[model samples]
Target chain A: MASARLPNLGAGNYFGLGELYAAWKNPEIQEMALHTSLSALGYVDILRVPAPILEEHVFPFMETPTSTTMEIAGTPVADDALMEWAVEERFVNATRVMVIDLDRCVRCDDCVRACASTHGGNPRFRRHGRTFDSMMVANACMHCADPVCMIGCPTGAIHRSVEHGTVIINDITCIGCATCANSCPYNNISMVAIRNPDGATITDPDSGKPIFKATKCDFCDGQPGGPACVRACPHDALKRVHFQELNPAGMAT
Target chain B: MIRRSALPFIVIGIATFAVVAWYARFTWLELGNPSIVTGYTLLVLMLMLGFFNIRKRLSMVPVGRTSLLLAFHVAAGLLAIALFWLHTGTLWPTGSYERILAVLFYLVSLTGILGYIILRSLPRRLTQTGIEVVYERIPAELGEIREKVEALTLECTEKTGSDTVAQHYIGTLNWFFRRPRFGLSHLVGGDAAGHWLRGPGGAARRYLNDVEKEYFDQILELGTLKILVDRHYACQDLMKKWLLVHVPLSMAVILVSIWHLLLVNVYAI
Candidate 1:
């Protein structure tokens, strides 16, 4: 979990310690410290307090519903009621995206190997491609908030699923230009050499040539437990987390 | 104001038709198959246009005209995909070169399409919510502001007898250094620069000078925000990045196109 908070940092025990030390001497940190003086006292207490600590978990209170409705079809329908009834549809616009729980990840290469095996010999998936805070992040599409890959697609071949909010590369529509491969910030998209069964490969229906498409972890939309890699992990290392729910302030406790 | 360089896309319709004609002739002559020729031709053109330099050149004149070119680029590419299918006349084939070319073209087109969506739609929506100041800009701004902030720290140090340089650096970098590249633009968004530059003209009596002045303000603001400095290096990185994708993909498109042509010729013969 701690590693997950800083996935870009890569694997190492003293990850970013040098940078952190530098930050400690920074004026912005000092200013922020001075402003949060009251909160600082509690933070100071944490240093003074013993490491092994116990705390009671309290359920947070939910804010009261402030209801508003858009007139869809000459109806003054309750928005909340309609939304509650259509929970799946509401998930279509979900802002809560997934995160990699790095601590539990063993990096055994099962996910990577499984992805390759499932998708033929193409090595589009990685068990530990990138990292954050001394933890290696297994390479998979992050399904980013603002996906860069979606930008350059001339056709709407790549789109976010309204239901899952997952970035998808529509296979049939995809023209295999490798534009998304270049645009991806995380380098998550993998190009695959697609083949057909019967020990033979196929050609693009249109171009009369082999069909290649960008493939990545689709979170196993119809498969059991979502993703095959996650499900197949022997170490139980993989789990999708809602970043907002997990880390409100982006700090690992 | 839309820059003047996007002129070619204005006549994209004519260019596209001409390219198609050229493609049809070349394909029939070389491949002896219309569909194969069309598919490969479309792929080559799409990949070429996908190049940032080419796109920039096309977008020089009128934004609308450039947009029309972009639309044609997209349409021709799609039609070419159909032509590819028609050229093959089947889903599966028994040739390696034939399949490789087709596959490469497919991937290139698909990725290009995805890129278009991100360029056209995603940026507008995402730019509205939380402006993603380029990472390059963040560091440069930090450095520039770092100089000023460090000087301020030195002044404070002289007075207070405390070496809090580190503290000050962090403080200023986080608070002041990392800022939206275009705060006002993000707030009012897109046409705000145009509005500011165009003044009250609303495109009626606007001159090239007016457009240039608007661009000047934009460039000046970008400089002030240190965006230009960041982008100076960043432009190279961006260009390289796109080149890695666009240029090679274009080459692949052309290669596959030639192969597709020859294969169709042999098949017909």
Candidate 2:
């Protein structure tokens, strides 16, 4: 749409992509969105067209009959339940999602170790999750499309990134109430005891309760190389992908 | 990771080690003090291997990729063994202190090899069982299965009005339901568990009436599920427990190597 808007701008003579980007940057020329501006600046990819969601996963959790039903419907290994969880949780919102091809995974916990390498000492996700014959969806945040975890935060600390749609928690504002942790159906969010730099647990000054903070996979946001877990996987086993890419036939349940 | 390209790395590593060994052999014959150089190099290699544990602990630090580090550690292990053989110059060292160091080194090497074998083979076998469970949660999963079995048994007794199924529970099936039984059987890929489930676990089936047989089938279903749990425990448990042996012995070997380093400097120098 923005490309169409810019087709006739600057005397309709576009020299190059830079001139298009410069004209887009100028508010007088065109009111460019931050996402579009970022794309023009080569910082992020702007999806010019809509992505194709799975046919079976046309409805969100609220509209679907299975929203409150926690039971596995049928053939959880690689059937309806698999994509249902993905779509219901709104995994399509994020730019990329983590997927594990279990046949290639050796259970070495290298991804977990890499995650710990990025975060401080605490590996954000366990290598265990729902599995079919070999594929496993590890218990890490999917940065959901709806982000139910963000809804009940008392302080609005857990919010999606304006630029990248990454659901991030502001540690300074997070009161450790665990609303987001509880709200997450996949149990991706973990309530960890906040610790000092010396590795001692920090306690509340009055109640003496250990200070707790909810943590999970952040998609390695702001990291220079992006998603350390995905990069550190030596075996081409792990990947950050969209739900549209998953094929049930490939994973033999 | 995948061992696809590791063949080249292995070939190059072995070739490089052979060349070093030849140089060390010449030094031993001509210079009469190659053990010192080999010992120092082995000590450094051992220290690097030990640092892998530290790297695991300080997981937050982005020093290097863990698989790359682990690959280096394995390579160092192989080279260290070759260096040890060169240092002693004989299969068994005559010196009392040297013998103790050699013995400890041998144990460490053996355990490390066993650990690596366990690491390489069991994970794919685990996936074949069509079950994925966290090691810590195995007991809870077993407990839940046991609970369901117990309830089904109660229903069978109430509906059938016979203690035959109840007696079977107290006698044979109860033992299997209690915990992760037949762990060793599962580890060796034995069908003893399935045999026991059908043979011993099915002993009461003949005594059951048509109505009672239905409940027994449900019990059998839960038993099969528990067996999958047992398989998971067997694979995951061995993978974790082997490390306990490898790590403590590694620390001991390092200590012995440190002592060996001191004694040679004190007396031979």
Candidate 3:
């Protein structure tokens, strides 16, 4: 019906209008026309375009645009401001970042308690870490994009989970070598000595030596609701954010 | 489902010492000799510790996790030290061969202890710096920063028509940029680069024109980045080089130990 209507406009209006109509029907002409129309209307602000459209159309053709402010429909829209708004709204970072908003935290230790309870009374992660403003990214296994801790593991005990990509230690296979503990730049992994059921230290009878195991957070693998620490945080201060999911270009206001 | 904790290790270590002490006393008093038993035990432990390197090499095989072996290796090492004392019955050995063996043993033990201390403390120290860098990438990163600095210097000299920054770079900062500098300072957590940059960079800034100042700002940023790269190198280099000391000495200890074992068997027997 739209195709039929195009010809009617040409026949009723002007002599050369038919040629224009035929040209407009071509895909290349259609794209050029759209581009010209948007440019003429001063709608060239890439940020104002919907994300999918901008990503598909503008981003590929444009020079990598420096983030700056531009006017859209008589309103000045700052790209950095848009990024900030997106970060708050969508939690975007080019790298995955696990952040805890400390201002919202009551420090009740429920998250720690929950983690310990789930992990047989030994909390995998510590509550302390470097803080920025009020946000404290607690000492937890980041399951880094490139895990150096995996390098020298003799038994391949520390590995990425196939399902979730969380770095996990095989408890059954883990030998308390402390290699992972030492290798971890964040000091997130720890060497723990294992004990027998009688509450005595398990020792090699021949050498009279204690046995050790390397331990760290596994991000609650196979748990129904994901990370117990995040789930148990009643104050909602804790969040397991992947920095990669965060829009790198956007800043959160 | 056993919980991992240090309490078990502490308890085990104390228990091990108590048992070893009791065994040494009983063997000396009742059997009229502890050296035969303790010496053999020490030899076996040295063998086991030597095997740890082999285990590390065969990482692809699922024989056992290296961590477990390392834990066993450390425990065995401590036990071997205790047994060495029991076997010798004195701090110093008397025979020339015995003394040589003693020297090698002590050297091995000292390095082990130092390595253990480094292993325990270095990670925390690295984290405190809050700069995470891969050991292998440090050189590449340093190269990139060097290139950036050189480009900025060239740009500053060309755009501003003044070689003040360029001359300053050549005179002072050239040595800093040539390769990783202040490595020892970085290892000790000293900011020699920062101090130098602030002093010299500030001094140079007064001579810079406004346009040159912009280029200088970029250069300063690159300089700061270089300092961080150096810090990464110092920390990572220490981590890598210490292993060089520990591993080779460990190998030498094993070799000399085997030779000593044969000598003891040939003469003493």
Candidate 4:
């Protein structure tokens, strides 16, 4: 039942308290206000007023009913159908869903580059995953509420971030077991062989055996203003939306 | 949310049982002849269970929540087991062909239950080990470790002018490092490799000079890495192998079940 503040209807069609008296005085303006309010409430069908009904039943009753108070009545503005569809689509269950509007997305790799640059030239997420219509929920950690990936970390290295709730692997303690990588049902986590700054494989000094660690999108936890991929999408095609907040209507291209 | 959604299904299952019980107690209808209804229900449940793989493959299509589907699949599978018990009305079948069907059915159910248990438990066991690995890449990773170990052993022999450590590695660790070993031990969470490395493998260290001892330490570290790799293979392999049992048996159950249905309709009727 979240209400949206109505934007200005048109030039000189102010519906605020400042212009309330003027809107009340003019019948044509009041009718326009009624139409706009109804439209805003998604009652477009009601606006198809027959000429006789509008002039006789509706307009005459306006003064009696008090045009000063425009009580627009219809279904609530919230799209319950869209919300239900999103939930049915499993969008609401995802923690941090990186959705791409395929229509808007030009298949440009800017988001990929942004992710790579943020994470020392290694992108944390892949560009593909399950898609519904034009919207693709890319291969990024949803930081699932029930992360199966956390089930078998012997060292307790892979854990949820206390502040942000992001699933992060503690590199120092991670034994490079790849249990988490295999456990991730979505294949979001990737096991990368550890390397020194100079690109030499980081290995035990004693054994000289190469090391590996599980890596995935951390939702750009410490980055100012949030995920670099979302920020870097020039066309606004990519967004990190909570599944619950996903608007199915917005994704309809 | 799962519990809430499952309530209706549970209620329906109870209703089905109650109806069957009432019919058996009071009605002239025979309980043995009630197999058609229950059998059909079981068949439908099996078909639903089979569709789970299809659902997984069609993730892009907006069918429904996979978690919700999985919950239904689990519940339906259990209910199907109950229906199976009721349909047969006995643990063992008398006829040979009937026995085969029952055996396949039981095997399918047993494997399904075992797979579910493993799915629930193995993740926790995997997390207990700090190392994470991709199952398919284990061989390549193991190869890298073997190469590193071999290089370390060769360097130790060259620097210290001794083949004691090198000779010991050749005799004891050569084949071990070449490929994944102690698979069954790793599967059952045994640390026999670690024990051998520390005990017999560490025995080679005493014979080595200071420089070779350093290399010995490196070889021990490589051995530890190999053990981790072995453990990964064990757990991952089991996880993958469980499906081989579960899926094919499920298919066999369905195939034998259809044959049972045809026989029941054509002759038994």
By lDDT, the best candidate is: 2
Candidate ranking under TM-score, highest first, comes to 2, 4, 3, 1
TM-score for each predicted model, relative to the true structure: 0.30, 0.72, 0.52, 0.53
Runs with alpha carbons beyond 4 Å of true place in candidate 2: A1-94, A101-123, A144-156, A159-165, A174-187, A190-214, A222-253, B5-12, B26-32
**Cα error, candidate 2, residue A241 (Å):** 4.5
lDDT of each: 0.46, 0.73, 0.65, 0.71
lDDT tens digits, residues A1-253, model 4?
A: 5543322132233333323433444658644333334133211222243444555555455543333324322345453444444445544546787987654453445578678877877899987766654567788988876688899899999999999888888889999899999998778899898877887778877888878889999888776657877766534568877665566557423
Tens digits of per-residue lDDT, candidate 4, B3-72, equal 3555676677677766765554443365356677667877887898888766554433445555456566
lDDT of 3 by residue, A123-162 (tens): 8887777554445556788777667789899999999999
Worst 10 residues of 1 chain B by lDDT: B58-67
lDDT of 3 at A53: 62
Put down candidate 2 lDDT per residue, A35-147, tens digits, no spaces: 22211311233333221232123322223232111232222444464554544454434335567776556555667878986788788888777664567777788786557
Candidate 4 chain A, poorest ten consecutive residues by summed lDDT: A38-47
Candidate 4 wrongly placed segments (more than 4 Å): A1-253, B1-16, B19-32
Q: What's the residue-level lDDT of A210 in candidate 2?
A: 98
lDDT of 1 by residue, B1-269 (tens): 12122344435545655666677778687856566555655556555455433533332122232333445555556555555555566765568876777677777777666544433332233322222333344565547654654455455446555444335335433343344333334322344433432442223222324434343343233334443333223322332244357557757777666666676669765
Residue B177 lDDT in candidate 2? 93
> For candidate 4, what is the TM-score?
0.53
RMSD to native for every prediction? 26.5, 12.2, 22.6, 20.6
